[model samples]
Target: MSHHRSPPSPPPPEPPESPSSVYCTPSPQSKATTPSPTARFFLSRHQSFIKPSPLTKHILPRQQSSNTLPPEFPYEHDTAKTSVGLYLRKHRRTNPAIWCSAIICLIFSILFIFIVVAILIIFLVVKPKTPVLDTSHATLNVIYFDSPGYFNGDFTFIANFSNPNKKLNVRFEHAVMQLYFEDGLIATQSIQPFSQRRKETGVVVIRFVSSLVSMSSNHARELQKQVMSNKVFYSVRGTFKVRASLGAIHFSYWLHGQCELQMSSPPSGSLMARTCKTKR
Candidate 1:
């Protein structure tokens, strides 16, 4: 037999170690003794950690807090307007331009208040009133027509302008008078400018001559009928520019006067009844 002996049988397997074999606590009796390196390593890893509960939640802030902002404050939305007053008005700063702006604003405010006061005072003191106008007399000098549509007439009137204001003198300028038979305008004339003292009346004499003035057939026929019946209807309209004088303050306005007259016909016609209205 060959002398090659089989390999020595393997050593028997050792028993498994306990689960706590890698870690051990030092007894109080060995407190003063230093541990080995391996023991120190195991001791260092002997910490205990708690597991998180499934139902628990963390407390975290919805937003981070800072000294520059208040918590839960109601704030106005910021805008991007480009006005210079957004930066300069009512802000705490040492700008010299702010003083100049403030002074100008104050001056303007004072001027506005002074102007308002002056107007109120003037209104109270003046107590201005409008003047009055009246038609005192009318005369139909003559009337003759060549044809039904052709008209010829001569008319005269006296206009009385009265100043009813207790403290105002009135002047009348750019005066014009118009004569109408029914709805047809027959003639127009301009009068001279005049003036009147307070509470005084002034008269203006106006004469109108119509030659070959064309009228509608209805107006012509109506005129003939009225002349035959010895009753003529005429309209007189007058316009004037009136100025009221109150010491250093004077104001002007337009004045209008209208008169309706019934008169006897032909050469001796005179006003029988009248209605007048004046307005501004």
Candidate 2:
């Protein structure tokens, strides 16, 4: 055996190294382990898969915004690769549009209820009543005829307006006065807007002077006949926009006043009698 001693051949060449094994055990300036061009390409492509085991737990993805975090967020870091700010996303799932709409609806409902209650209280506390119109005095100063159908006259009157409601005040707007003879319009006059306290009376002096007013045949004949008998008949109409108010409650309506007057003929002519009525 000593005379036949011979060294054994080296072991057969190892199988080609794989990229995965070569990249994991990287060493600088080592000829035997140096990767070939093909192996280098494979190593470069697979380099991202091989990572150091700094910690075992998986790291969450980084959030784009900090405000996307929870209202009560506690920072935690379980791995060296993960940051304290990165946390699992919790979708709060809220509807801001629906919440805003609900708030607006609630406010409107409260306002409507309050307004209804206030209006009801006003109606109960202040019951509105109609005002009255009456005449205190009237006189016919002159009457002259330019023709059978054309006439001139001067009339004067004091109009009395009274508020009957003890709790409601009254105001008259756009007041106008018209004089008629035998259902025919003779003259018109204007009166200023006026106000009256509760249960108070207001007076306005009105004067009408007919200047060359033409009358119908029936009206002229009736006027002539009345003048002959020393008893003249005339009518007056009043139109007003009346507002009745108590505190903050206010109601408005149109009022019509009609009066019939009997007067003695010419020059010291005075009102003998009058009948008046007011309607709403």
**All models: lDDT?**
0.81, 0.84
Identify the candidate with maximal TM-score: 1
Candidate 2 lDDT tens digits, 14-114: 77888765645445767677779999999887987877464522343335333354434534323422543355443576699999999999999999998
Runs with alpha carbons beyond 4 Å of true place in candidate 1: 1-123
Mind giving the per-residue lDDT tens digits that candidate 1 earns over 1-280? 6797788999999777788776567887787587878888777677334444544334433344323334344242123233435776656666889899999999999999987876576568867666666777788988888877889999989887888878878898788989988767999999988888888987888889999999999988899899999999999998889988778767788998899999898798898999988889
TM-score of every candidate relative to the true structure = 0.61, 0.59
